[model samples]
Structure formats: structure tokens, C-alpha cells
Target: MAPVSAPDAALRFVHPDLDRGPEAGLVVAGDGRLALATGMLAIRQSILMLLSTTPGERVRRPDYGCDLHRLVFAPNDETTHGLAMHYVEQAVATWEPRVQVIHIDAHRDPHAEHVMQTELHYRVRRTGIEDSASFGFDLSGGGG
Candidate 1:
């Protein structure tokens, strides 16, 4: 079944702190109330958090996280590269609904032993602004 499209609405920057995530925005007011992050700030944090999480690490939500951590020990090859790409896409799609991923590239560093780097390109949902982030997973360790 096809999903219904949401009506076109202006992007509203004001919101409660709960939707923004665990950490407060880098900007602050003298009153000390955490200001909600907007534009690139919010998108960057969401991407980082989604990619850093492991599937089983979250309480109650066993399936909540990118599969990058699972590929830490997997043999690095064409198959592994594809799996890493899939993990990034799935995690980003599931966790951060505010942005749509445009491109994802994952490859192993030849000189750096046991390292896989993922480059992500995405656009914000409402604003249509594009940005990129690079993440590295140390295969020597168990996490990304």
C-alpha cells in the first residue's frame, strides 16, 4: 500500500528539548534552558548518534541501531563493503526521519589496518539543505 503524503508545511524550529536528543545544542542562553537545535546542527548530531549506536545496546529496543558495530570483525571485502553501506542506510532511515540520505560510500583504508570509513551525503527534509559527514569504524575494536 502507498503511504499518504504529508501536507506541505513550513519548517518550525521551536520545539521541546525531548525531540532534540540527549545532548543540548552547542548554542545556549543565559537563562540556561537548552535551546533546540535546528538546521545542520540537529541533523549532524542525529546522524552521529545513529551511526554510533549498536543494535542491542539500547534498552528495550533491541533492533534500534546501525549494524556497523556488527561488521567490526567481519572479513573486509566487497561483501563487507556492501553490508556497511546497507547498515548506514537502514540506520539513518530508521533513526533520523528529518533527512533523506542521497549517497553513502563505505570503503576500507589500505594503509590503516582494521579500519573502515563511511562517507554520508544527505538532505534535510523540510529545508532541502545538503550536508555530508564522515565516520570511521575501528575494526580492531568492537564498536564503530
Candidate 2:
């Protein structure tokens, strides 16, 4: 019999492929094997990593990241939020092919003038699973 190809084997299975962050450090599982994220957890991890990375930060894949960091000093107004949303949408669309972006929103924190809260909504293409991720951007120039 011919060898069972990887793609063929994958098609025969129902579980989604395992996910590991490109920059995430190795994690030890309870069983001693490496831990890997799967399903929605994996997708969420990927989204977080993508958002955290800055374009050109990676040596080999210089273009594999979001540019939201560039707006750190931008005015916390509608224009700034619009630019942030554009950056997020473009980054997610360009770097992550597994999910379709539904919406992106950015708003200044009512309590903190130098903080901007961003929320992202996306749907997994293969399973149609929907989820959201939120993070904050610090504009205080504290350099954390």
C-alpha cells in the first residue's frame, strides 16, 4: 500500500492542528512533554503574539507583526483610534490567515488619559468559531 501522506492523515482527523507561538518559550507539560495550544486557545495565543510583535522586530520575518506601537505618542482622539484600528486590521489580515477579522475598536481609558484600550473580534475560518481579544496600549512613555 502507498504511504499515508501527512495531508491525507490530517484530513482523516477531526481535531485542528496544534499551535505553538513562534516566539513563545518552551513550556513543559504535566506529562513532561512540550505543551501546545489548540483550537480557540491556540487562536487566542496567536492573536496576542501577533499584536505584541512589531513589524521589522523579527530578523528573518521582518514584516510579520502589527504597527500599533507606532501610535504610542499619538493623540488619544478619533483619528488616533482610527489609525489604531487600521493598523490592527491590516496586521491581523496580513499575518494571520487562520481567522477573519470582524471588528476592531480602540478607545481612550476614562480613568487614565495615557492608556488606550483595544478590542479585536475574529472568526476562525475552518470552524467558524468566533472570539474576541482585548489589550491595552500605554501612552504614558513609562517604557514598560
Candidate 3:
């Protein structure tokens, strides 16, 4: 008799993957509300770091770039996104008119989108001011 395969045996799944070139233009909606997919925590961190700058501090980059900006976490959980937005809003408030948010992720972060929108709305309402700016939020991924 042949041996039976384990019910939960680990298997490697592979497909004929195609090598796509580099990405093109990337844009981040300044409306404020944003939500990322799962497996994108690193990207969220990077955005926070970028927005949060002290009086004088040098920006440093690690050897390899980090990739984490998804929003497929546990059901109805927005902790990470909330923290990120809080930091972003604080930075924006401190550096208003000179802060440009750039979000690079592998998917459209719904949490991030929503957060950004909410912050921007609040800022507009409180300050009664507006300005045009350029930001980047690169989303790259293969829809499963």
C-alpha cells in the first residue's frame, strides 16, 4: 500500500511567472483616507518615518528596501493604520504647507486612504486653509 500524504503537508506552489519592468508614475491621493492590503507593514513604517522629521535630522536608508503596506489584517482591525495616520497628522500639523505625504505600497491601502481623507478634512475644517502639493503612493501587486 502506498504511503498517504500528510493532511497538512507543506507544499511549494509555483507558476510561470513573468518578469514585469519597473513601475511608472505613482500618485498618492491627498484627500487623506487610505487603506493598504496585507503584508505591507514595512511600507507603512517608512511613510511614518518620512513624514516625521525633527528640527534637523538626516534620513537614512537600509541596504534593502522594505515592502509592507497591505490591509488584510484580522477582521475589523485598524490599529496599524490608525497609528500611521496619527503620526502623519501630527507631522502635517507641525509642517503644514510644506508636508507632502508619499505612500508606496503593493496595493490600494483602503485604511490609509480613509485615514488621509479624514485627517485632511479635519485640517481643512479647523484651519480653513488649502494648498496644492505633490505626493507619491506607488501601489504594485498582482491581484489574487
Candidate 4:
């Protein structure tokens, strides 16, 4: 039998959903399914970071609560998007005054989740806040 030719290095791994590997430098359009999962993960991480920074005195407030800030991954679908937006708007109106919001992600999410967060903190200034402020220690690769 002839020796087997090695599979194309680039095509060796195929995503079950994608028949062709993405072309070089081409970006995949964001998928609603992936966005929903990623957004949830990012929101969860943000909340955890917020809680970790809370001073011991502030943890017991009865009025304070956390919820998934709802959002629609589909922009043109009004019935669904409107419902999602309405839910988030109501939650924001109810919760903004009681709790602080945090965003933790490598790349900013531009969907409904991030939009609500942006509006929530629009007035707050991040002037002196370093990227490492929330992380407790600066991991910037620079000498002292």
C-alpha cells in the first residue's frame, strides 16, 4: 500500500459545523449561540470579581441582589429583541441604584449585555483606574 500523505496541517481539525476552514485573516461572524454562552460566562466572572472586591461591611444588604442582565443576540428580530431589552431595562431600573456593576472579558462584548453595563456606568469616571485595578495586582510586563 502507498504511504499515507499527512493531512493538511491547517485542515486537520474541522469544526463539525463548518465544512471549510476559515480563510487566513478572515473573522467569523459572531454566532448568537456562542455569544449567549460567552456572554453568560463573562457576566458570571464580572459578578464574581465585584463580590470579591466588596468591603466586608457591604455584603449583608437585604436590598442587594444579582441577576443576569438580559439581552437579545438578534438585532433585527424585534419581537424577541424587544422582549429581551424590556426585561433588561426593567432590571436595570430596579437594580442600578442598589449594586455596583463590573465587566470582565478579554474582548468587549458589544451585545445587549455590554450595552446595559455601559449605560449603567456611563457617568462614572475610570480616569485613575488601571487595567489591573480589579485584579489587585498589576501583571503588566514592565520593570519596577
Write one digit per residue (lDDT tens) for candidate 3, span 53-137.
3333554533122122342232223554454345445555554333343331122246554222222222132234432222223
Score residue 5 of candidate 1 by CA lDDT: 36
In lDDT terms, which candidate is top? 2
Candidate 2 on 66-144: residue-level lDDT in tens? 9888987888889988988999999999988889999999999888788888899999898898999887777665543
Q: In model 1, what are the clashing residue pairs, if there are any?
A: none
lDDT of 4 by residue, 1-144 (tens): 243322211112222212234543223435522112122222333333332232242457543332222222333233433443343334434543323333332222244222212112211122322121111111121110
TM-score of 4: 0.23
Q: Which stretches of candidate 3 lie over 4 Å from their true place?
A: 1-77, 97-119, 122-127, 131-144
- Badly placed stretches (over 4 Å) of model 1 are 1-37, 142-144
Better of 3 and 4 by TM-score: 3
Candidate ranking under TM-score, highest first, comes to 2, 1, 3, 4
**Where is model 2 more than 4 Å wrong at Cα?**
1-27
Q: Of the pair 1 and 2, which is ahead by lDDT? A: 2
What Cα-based lDDT does every candidate model obtain? 0.72, 0.76, 0.32, 0.28
Superposed Cα deviation of residue 58, candidate 2 (Å): 0.8
Candidate numbers, best lDDT first, in rank order:
2, 1, 3, 4
User: What TM-score does model 1 achieve against the real structure?
Assistant: 0.70
Local distance difference test, candidate 1? 0.72
